[model samples]
Target: MKVKGYPMLASLLAVMLLVGLQTPAYGENATTRATWIWQTDLIKDGGEELLHFASDEGITLIYLQIDRQLPPEIYEAFIKRAHENQIAVHALGGDPRWALTEHREDMLGLADWVLNYNGKVSTGARFDGIHLDIEPYVLAQWEDETDEVISTWEQNLIMFLNQASGSDLELGIDIPFWFDRYTLGNGTSLNEWLIGTFDQVTVMAYRNQVESENGILDLTRDELELANRLGKQILIGVNTKEMPREPHTTFYGYGKESLNAKMEHLSSALGSYASFAGIAIHDIRNWQNMSSDVTVPPDEEEPTTPPPDPDPDPNPEPGEGDRVPDADPITRDPVVRGTYIWEAHEVIRNSQEILDFAKEKNLNWLYVRLDLEQPYTKYSSFVKQAAAAGIEVHALGGHPIWALEENRPRMMRLVNYVKNYNRAVEGDERFHGIHLDIEPYVLPAWRENSQQVISEWTANLDAFVTELKKDSNLEASMDMAVWLDKYKVTGQDMSLSKWMINRMDHVSLMAFRDKAEGSNGIIAVAKEEIAFADELGKPIKISVEIKASHEGDHITFYEEGAAYMEEELAKLPELLKDSPSFTGSLVHAYAYWKNAKP
Candidate 1:
């Protein structure tokens, strides 16, 4: 034992044997933090920013978009740079439509591109894997002809899997968390088949919260177990893009600190299982914006499967206002108080009366349109008085056509005009936010071709937000109908309500019902929207109609006296005490309500 170099020689041999026998740990806490990067981001000078952002987020792998047009040298440089930082890059590209026979060659083209790139680059610059995000569910046939489409999807998947298996490259696929709900013709669940078929699979479990029935953990639990059984690893993805409204499904609303906390919770729940890899934030840009410190914990030896559903009812006995939390409790004071102020001229002339009425009613916000033609001095004076009375003013004026491409600039001009005035005016005198009342469904074209019109409308709004966000950071809100959740968009497969809510900072739901009680009343109509808003942590301002309507008794409070309205509104706080984002109630218009007869 005390011999000259014997101990040193034995230690060197042991180290060599350990190194030779050791295999990659595809187990719990042996996680890889991954992010997606669009092709445009990777080819431009901005690519460096992406790399820097990834490094900051502690990203171990990047699924970079494959750009065949990009020069080989650029790809090599990016891959080399990533590798130097100990990051693996996977060439990513795919389209759900490509699942068709006509697009089969193009789908294969992605693999060919990766193979070609790998051959061209040095060993250090080569891609570590390939990731395809071909979502076939959005296709029209998927809904109308499900069996055929599923078959086609299966065929294309098999072909792609075969090609990957034949090649030297490692392959991964992005799948919706609901894949477990679908079964293949062979009787295996789609998720199980996928985990069995690929080197890796990423579940798009994109909700911000990690708890709850549909949260990331619950959605991915099955896949995590299956992947472990199959001796594979899976990444759970979360979204970061800003949504139009709340039951916000992305981390954009959670902020960095909360996201970090939620990720820790996710790890705590899943890290004990074998095959429980780390979280993968959706795209690089959003992850960069998030800026969370990702820390991996020490691994533990455990079974691969998830623990049986944590006692289906965590609490068997019901308690007052007791329910399982969808997310961490974020408290906000109950707000249900405001009214619309129509007629710009009347508001300016009767400013004192409006202020007094608002104070008497304990209103906190006023939705009104601005008359820029009026003297700025007079306008500022009224707004200042309103603020002194503890009332926030939100400018409201938008036509359905404003959401069309041709009229978008005009709408933008209006937004810019408000921002310019705000910059010039004192804080209290300026409008708090812009409320766009552009109801796309009210347009004639929408009635005839709802899908196309709605698509165009949503795209227009997205473009407007893109431009508005570029120049102005003012709060922007939109008006929406409660029924919007019923209609689904063709290409997106999501409800119109969901699409719109994801685009706005917040939404004012037109829960215009005369009665506050009963099944067909204000609360019933607004229940769904309010629940959604609560989930997303987005505030919702429910509006009731006092103005006489051409519709019917059910939609307007015209005949219901002001006293009845107050009585009904009083019931909201108790009714909505459980909702995290029940901002409060708003009356339709001041002019109508001020003059309404009992």
Candidate 2:
């Protein structure tokens, strides 16, 4: 549902005339409260719990994401119960890819399923409407082919409308508030056009504050005015889910009381308008778990004042517990032609083959996965061999859960294992560094409580470095996603990318796009990270994807072949000549690249 960047406008007057619409049955003077149920399995698995939560939250409308695989009877049973509780259910389904012509069938299929299911269901079980949450801006094409993307997106919506013609079901769409900034070819704002085209338009006016510049009210004002002028319902959508990257967009840490107060204020300010359909929280799961008080638990809600910040931990002296005297600082070539070795056991079984491949590829560094269960001699022999061949080998291991406080020991164990191994080895046989591949965003808790995950991830990094620097001069490096620049450290003005670059000896940005250049390519996405690293005088390597990805053909060099990948990668040196921090590039792994067509 989150789309990046700004958009242009469009006019939908002609389209509206072509397809007549019916307004949903919102009782006279009754404020329509709604929530999204994105997890469709809940309909069959936890129907009672879901219905009870909806009734308690006073949610009048539920936007249930359609799961076509589920039995039609499950939908009927759930919708019937929801109807009994006076809650109307609307089928919801969409993807950013739906904006493309080839993906139109997926969009139309949702509509056909809903209409077909409605025909066989009882009145109470019938879906009241269809809600589309397609966010085309998330597409790679949105950056370079804005016009074409918008045109296709509009065409897809028209196709959807044409498919739904003659149906009683109302149509609605979720759009960001900034759609008004995008002026369509016909000179109408996209927001206004959408408001005119659909039976209802839910403006994602997601902000913790309801007033002030860039707040919910300011962002939604134009859409509200347009909705009023067009005499269409405009449901203001607020977010309860955690958004660590854009913290101000959600009322996650603000508590339920604050959310209710802000919604009350919003209602007071815009309730007079006929088009004001009322507030819609982004979802039900998070809203249900939102605390009544910001800082205090529901059971212990007496505290009114915020807790004071804790004192910072002082730096520990070297040679403390499990710490040895610091080893002399090691230096290496600034250039980083690296690749990952995920199967460490391969090094033991095929040392010569791995070395021959690395040499052939001219790789200078290897992030070799450390198998702690194996004897020390297994890694020692490979590290010594790699070092003699002028290749730096670093230990690599991580998991998503390693980002949480409860899982700190698991992460520390890896750090300690490497540190202890270094203490017992000769300089040439020792690991050059530790390369972490922790992708905390993959954790389910990351979506539910992102701020907490970020905090714990940061703490784990601190523990990692502290343990790493205890007795060795090992370099600290990690693989990070390119988009992490969007997130700021909770209390810091700097971005997460900058913070990591400043802390680590060097970092590898997973700029997975196949192309080295162009708006949606690797260079464009890694630009910010490279700049940040340059500012901090740190080194950064742009990592490319070779492993076949289902995401899209543009995501990997799999189909392009190794020869073509090298040809594209050959463009980086000249293009990034000015960036001293641009050390070099790294292919995702040895396994995929080894067998990749030449």
Candidate 3:
């Protein structure tokens, strides 16, 4: 959390009254007071005592550190206890370094860890929400590469929110109170965008007084007003923990009596705002020990360096410096906003719903499968309808061992079907491309005959791409797991993932992780793939799943519902803003996406 600025006086009578005042309950008329439970307090076996203190103090929320080192049962019991007392327990942990690309996967790992835990824990015992404390301004590079670092900060933030959106988790971020002073090159004010993006925001309004220019309410006024207008919640945070410099930074110097007085004044002054959720004390342990005799150091000096230039050219052409200077962008902007359609025939009957969905979601591409059992006329009509709706239809089909000579005909059949459809139809009614989803990993031969099967799988993909290009004028693409880059064919040194991307006009990464953030999740898995595609100048779509799966909860958002899935997908374009080859995204299939329960 970020802190800036300070305040003045309180009478002994007000201090005495403040100390005796009870912590308000959590409700609209009452302040929803919360506090951070540092990891240290949690490590000690004080769960019962912690709840007692919070309940007595009227803490409605406790941002608990996600300590995997502690037993799962510990958190379960603690959360169970907290919930019983009406205090929401949110998983909280983050570091400034997470803004770096290399460290982002680990940062996202925190969310995945929480999600995985929630999957196994009982619903009631699970975390009520996720509260991230990622303060990117603390990084050393932030001073020199302010624009780049802050952009990375927002990227990571959006990714984390995307992951949290996969569950029913209410997400909150801790931002410095002064974020309004910082603006992005895109004209987005940090505080405004942050508050607007999340479910709620807790400003680090860590001053000790109530009414002067640097007072608690004064510092938090901007956020409270903005949140009210946006219908988002804002929590005015205060400091209790003692720091090295500026004793005014915490209440330790003046004691709990003074602190309570200031908090009371803050609540009274800011409580009228609809967005003013409540006050959140910096921590629990420090509040418990208000007897430190720490001396005040001289006022800390502010950095002399000015912040990065906020207004960069917003209309640079493609292949210019819009992205990192390391790679050049494609001549044409990417056009891969797509979804797979397994029930190609059913689409004809449900053409309007499909068209409406495509138009509403800005989906421009469709990967429709060949249902041989359905009439050829049905496929043609659906393709025509899709074209009319401004959706480019890509003929989709695949089978394992497609690289083998014996199975090569199966792949050819799909290519031929699309060719025939194109030959029969004129202009816009014809298929725009062919998309293959052959996965050799699922084949029985993969395990029974490892080397040969692996070798054959790569060979088949190579053959298919080579043959498809020669036989069809339509654009060709294929889907593969993100880890294909890490895998090498039995006798070959080349990466399967890279090889596939290089050979195709486009590649869709079956980035399948339900959570969009984190290392093992969607964004991290696709990071390398996107970079490689950027280098190769091929367009790519990072696909996600909404369908139910026998696979683990971490792999699909079946339980998260459609609204949440949409929220997560909306974060993608911004998250991948720097990747020139990022064409957009692809939902796994039309049938599943439409039917997924909200």
Candidate 4:
């Protein structure tokens, strides 16, 4: 993962020192006034309005949130316009989970997405850099599992740094003013390390005052000094949004005029430091909405008025005094009826017929096999048509050999093919995800050396999921046998079933039994998996076989009419009503189910 042209820290520092005497040239080079655009969707219709505002405010840089769901053309148009206004746009994205090793793919995905996007776009529309705003301390685990969270946070950051290396895009991160208080295992301050590590560091000073005990200047002094020594650019950030708990932390009541004056004073105080790039407003929305009345004095210790309704937090890190309001819990779909389709070549030919069947069966999801050799246009029309009928199409392909390290290229071919296909197409036409059906146990290696095969399988799958997620928002899922709960992973404490459930966004458990209940029926077989998935807050899709099976009569629903199968499946929702992870069911396939007995 070593980037070919990545500069050494010392060499980068030397280059920075050579240019340190002059004002840091970012965008227009007029003391680096910047702001954040958290609601990037605004540009979909209001790009010109935003640019005009930026022009009037003399803003030089913008940290725009990355919304992959938004069309690339929206970004292209907005960024192109911003460039004309002399504003630099950096892609901004991150989450608390991104700090964990399990979610490293999500972090790296953002970087890869930007890199790929920049390559496809014109120079004027390309992003200037990537800015991560990951704050792991917000998670409850930070209170109880501090060491583990810290370890993973450091590891993920290193991985991100390595992934971003050799790229032309500048890499930056947002750190709280108090990061200097946290020390790494090596005893170096976290803020000091970050300042030296990244191209730029933006310290969230978030105080109305420029000076005072714990004011903006007081809080950012240590970071600014460290950045000066490391020869790194540092932007001091201030909040304009109302904070009910910490009234002094924001310029909400002070108005734009007061905030402007405070920023000017802050610039004067920190301007002497070579690394002091400029001031960054917390966000554009709040800054724009900030009252022009200047209700509170700039030197006031507290807000003169009660806080208004809280705005969405763009940099939420709840600490002792800075407590962010909890967001509403997310609810899952009541049921996700699904099926599998193996013959992908027929998709374009029989697009309407497939949609008709899917709608008739009320199937919301389909695992459609992907023929890599087939052109992307073959599936585009079918996928788009299926989407119109409220059905998601996931590209499916797998082989037993894909479980081996040597066969990774084969595995990645499917991933790359799907990724490139999605990039070429528009919304709904792209595959919703990749559904893997690799069953390594079928291979001779399984019996020859079970442990070694299991080890390779685990490594291969981990790489597959990681690579699949690195550039796209595709859901990584796989089919797991109901009995995998019995086999433990090579060295892990958990079973292979639990490992897969934890890793995949959702797993389709091949319970295969015709009956819904009984000692050895579908419900009983999937009980452990459903419970494990619920514990992880992931989903489980119980799959029943419709195709005739040579294995056993008990395994297939082919003997039973579609009416009888529906009768048994109807009991699942009521039986597993308490289990949130039971996201309905899937038939083994479309071919047999289509011609099954009524």
Give all candidates' CA lDDT scores.
0.69, 0.77, 0.70, 0.77
- The whole-model C-alpha lDDT of candidate 4 against the native structure comes to 0.77
TM-score of 2: 0.56
Candidate 3's displacement at residue 62, Å, is 0.2
TM-score of 1: 0.52
Candidate 3 displacement at residue 189 in angstroms: 0.5
Q: State the weakest 10-residue window (summed lDDT) of model 1.
A: 295-304
Instruction: Give the CA lDDT, 0 to 100, for residue 465 in model 3.
Output: 68
What is the C-alpha lDDT profile of model 2 across 455-489, one tens digit per residue?
88888888888888987899899998887766666
Number of backbone collisions per candidate: 12, 6, 2, 0
Q: Ten residues in a row with the worst lDDT in model 3? A: 1-10
TM-score, every prediction: 0.52, 0.56, 0.45, 0.49
Worst ten in a row by lDDT for model 2: 1-10
Predicted candidate 1 versus true structure: per-residue lDDT over 1-598, tens digit per residue: 0113345433433443343234355445555889888645445663677788778768899888877887878888888888988899898888888777778888888887787777776899898999989888766456456667667776776666555553556678999988788887767777876766666788888765566556777778888877666666677888875332222356653357667677778877887656666778877665565434321111122111212211211112223332224444445577748887656666777888888889887888887776654456667887898889888888776755555555676577667777777788888788888787766553435555778877777877787667667656777787888777766655865556655655677788888887777777777877766765665567777788886665677778777767887788788788877887777788887766776644
Candidate 1 segments whose C-alpha is farther than 4 A from its true place: 1-28, 291-477, 480-598
Q: In candidate 3, what are the lDDT values of residues 1-598, reduced to their tens digit?
A: 1211111111321332242233232225645788998654453574888889898888899999877677787888888888889989888888888877778887788889889889998977999888988887756476458789877887777667556654777778899988898876577798887877777689997765566556666677788778766667778788875331233456543456556666776677765777777888988877876533222211222111212212322212223322333434476565557788776445766777888888877888888777654556777777777877778888887654354445666677777677777788767678878888765553334445646766766676677667767755888788877766655556655556666777788888988777777656677767777877887777888888876664567667777877877787777777888888888788877766765666
| Backbone clash pairs in model 4 (N, Cα, C under 3 Å; residues 3+ apart or in different chains), count | 0
